[model samples]
Target: MPIIRVTSLSEPGLEVYGSLTERQLKSFYDDLGGLFIAESPKVIKVALDAGYEPVSVLCEEKHIEGDAKDIIRRSGDIPVYIGERDLLASLTGYTLTRGVLCAMRRKPTVSIADVCRDAHRVAVINGVVDNTNIGAIFRSAAALGIDAVVVTSNSCDPLNRRSVRVSMGTVFLVPWTWSDDYQQELNALGFKTVAMALTDKSVAIDDERLKAENKLAIIMGTEGDGLPQYAIDAADYVARIPMSYNVDSLNVAAASAVAFWELRNR
Candidate 1:
């Protein structure tokens, strides 16, 4: 429990918590490994529970003995950097929520086959660049019984700072991996693809036929453009959520929640 008082924003060991960009922090330990900053005690706890190694922690002085106590105890011997409230806020460029953050080591990337090997229900995040939506989808997937999540290379990283916080840490709870050829790999794994898209031939999300499938993969697309033509064409069924008020579609995150809940295995 080495506690370091951070007197200045430029303090040598505080880079990961303040100065470094997400990409820089990601590559911080490249030769040894990569790192990600987890904000809030709750999210940090979840990451720890998921076996993500901790590098260090930053805390506001008040929280050192408050919300951050348990995190400090769980952190073992890692350096716990503490600073006055205003100083920390200035350093982080925002007010700390629950007043704590942790720098965690990223795990090795898993393959699509590894993630979907025995998955009964999966979700594919295809090129969804918005971190908030990506996080929300993972949160929904976890809540609604999705076994795993596969994000295409172009999609936002589930471990992105905002995504992790927005998901309330479910990103760590769910098994996920990157996929270059998501469709081909899912098909090879024996999953019937259900693209969440609007098309003439699309079926209702709650169609009984969807629930009848042995293994299902729900494919979700970007915010503005929706699923690509190839993805729609490749899917066994293109499904749409029934809407009211003349709404044509739901936000990707909202639609994902509905689709996940509706198509979840009984």
Candidate 2:
């Protein structure tokens, strides 16, 4: 087992802890096949149970024999770095709430067509950047029967630690694909492209088109400014969830839940 020392802020092993920027961490992880940092012993254990590989683990010395032990056992001879509380803080550059973190390799990506091949309904994420919302959306998607999730290139990284934690690792379970350009491909796949937007010609969310279609892709947008006009124009149907007056909308995450529940098996 590799014993990593938390001696400096710049050490590579410690860099993986928390000191790196989100993008730097994502890049390093992508090179390692999109691995993710699973914070908290609970999250780590869940990922492992789901068949994710543990590259290494860092934990407070106290948890080495307690919270960290089972993870080590399941990980099979992987390095387990034990550090004093202050040392652990120095290594991660922040105080860890759960006192344990496991770095696990990401699951492989599937093509949109592959994910949607057998799916009757799917959720298309345009540019939702809030990690929490992304996580919440994944949970709703899984619970409400979105067959797959199609994400945009410009969206927040789904593998972000907060997102993964918020999702309870559902991000790994769902089949998703990143698409810089999905318009033509979705059109070719026979999915009725539906945009969630409020516009002059936008249809109500309860419109029969959503329920009648066999293959549907519900497109949601970022929090502010809503869906871009281009995306709205690209959609075959623009839909909005009817709401009470003076309440114009819902948070993207809540909106996703509402949409997914209604669209599921509709």
TM-score of each: 0.96, 0.91
Tens digits of per-residue lDDT for model 1 on 1-266? 99999998888889887888988877888975689989988899999999999989999888888988998888799998999888999998988888898999999888888888989999999989999999999999999999999999888888889999999999999999988688888889899999999999999998999999989999999999999899999999999999999999999999999999999988
> How well does candidate 2 match the true structure, expressed as C-alpha RMSD?
2.0
- Where model 2 places Cα greater than 4 Å from the true spot, the runs are 2-12, 29-31
How far is each candidate from the true structure, as Cα RMSD in Å?
1.2, 2.0
lDDT of 2 at 228: 88
- Against the reference, the lDDT scores of all candidates come to 0.91, 0.82
Candidate topping lDDT: 1
